[model samples]
Target chain A: MRNRLKELRAERGWSQQDLAERLEVSRQSVNAIETGKYDPSLPLAFRIAEVFAMRIEEIFLKG
Target chain B: MAAYNLAFRRYIRRFVPLTIAYGASVALATAVIPDGAPASPGIIAIAVLPGLAVVGWLWAMARLLVELDDEYLRMLEVRKFLVATGTTLALTSIWGILELFTPAMPKLPVFFVFPLWCLGLAVGAVFNRLRFGAARCA
Candidate 1:
């Protein structure tokens, strides 16, 4: 899956660590998800959506 | 992140003592039980200590898996364990076949399997780093 996590984070002036803190995950996980090396689980995706105040589809896109 | 850190610290606490116990048990067992010694209950009990220590190490690892909260990190750890298991099994099978076919092949001790699995874990960590871009999550 592809995602706009990096772009969204950039827009919000949030670092990976900041996003990870909000999501209750490690910075490495945030980096991995942003780089498309890993796809977050449904619950984690939901958390990411909540963090950005956006829908999951808006943050994550089909590849 | 706090959960992961706590779990990791717990793992270290368990691992350090278990390592010392493993070494002490091995040394004590070897010193007490000489080669060609008769099988006695005392000797058997002494010999079992090392195996028990190994079991403790395994238990520590399992506990770490259970306690870790980050799903991605946990998944990476599980993948590493699977890779280690696969490597250990494949190598042992190949060695067993070689021993069966080749009379010159040296017998591989069963105790070495644990160490072999450890080496496999290192290989798996490297594989994870290369493939997943992160090996040590903690």
Candidate 2:
């Protein structure tokens, strides 16, 4: 999966730490997901979307 | 800051007591039984009590992992445990095969598996640090 997590986080002036705090995960997790080294589970994906007030499809796309 | 949850704290607390008890039981069994002699069924049962504690520790570890809400820490833990499992299985199987052909090799009991697995986890923690920058886990 590919995601616009970094771009979205940047647009919101949120550092990876800021996003991670909101997601209740470590900054490394945000980094992993952003760099495409890790893919969030469905529940986590939903949480991410909720944090950004966007749809999951807007943030993540299937390759 | 890297932090552990209440469940993790409880897990560690539970581990300490169980480990002390396990050590005591193993020590008592070894001291009371004769060396190189087969023990009675009752004595064997007493000696294996520490083995049950080892299984309990694994269960606690699993429960701690499940209770964690942090994704990255959880990922690190899952990777570490998988690496540990692979290392233990590989080393033990190799040793078992070698013992069959090499008369000089010492025999390994099945009870030693958990200790080997624990050693593997230590090795896996080092691997995690190299791969992920830090070995943070609950």
Q: Which candidate number has the best DockQ?
A: 1
Residue pairs clashing, model 2: none
User: What ranges in model 1 sit over 4 Å off?
Assistant: none
The A-chain TM-scores of all the candidates are 0.97, 0.97
What is the Å distance of residue A30 in model 2 from its true position? 2.0
Residues B77-98, candidate 1: write the lDDT tens digits.
Answer: 8888888899999999999999
**DockQ (C-alpha) of model 1?**
0.76
lDDT for residue B106 in candidate 1, whole number 0-100: 100
**Residue range with the least summed lDDT across 10 consecutive positions in model 1 chain B:** B129-138
The DockQ-based CAPRI class assigned to model 2 is: acceptable
Candidate with top lDDT is 1
Minimum summed lDDT over a 10-residue window in model 2 chain A is located at: A23-32
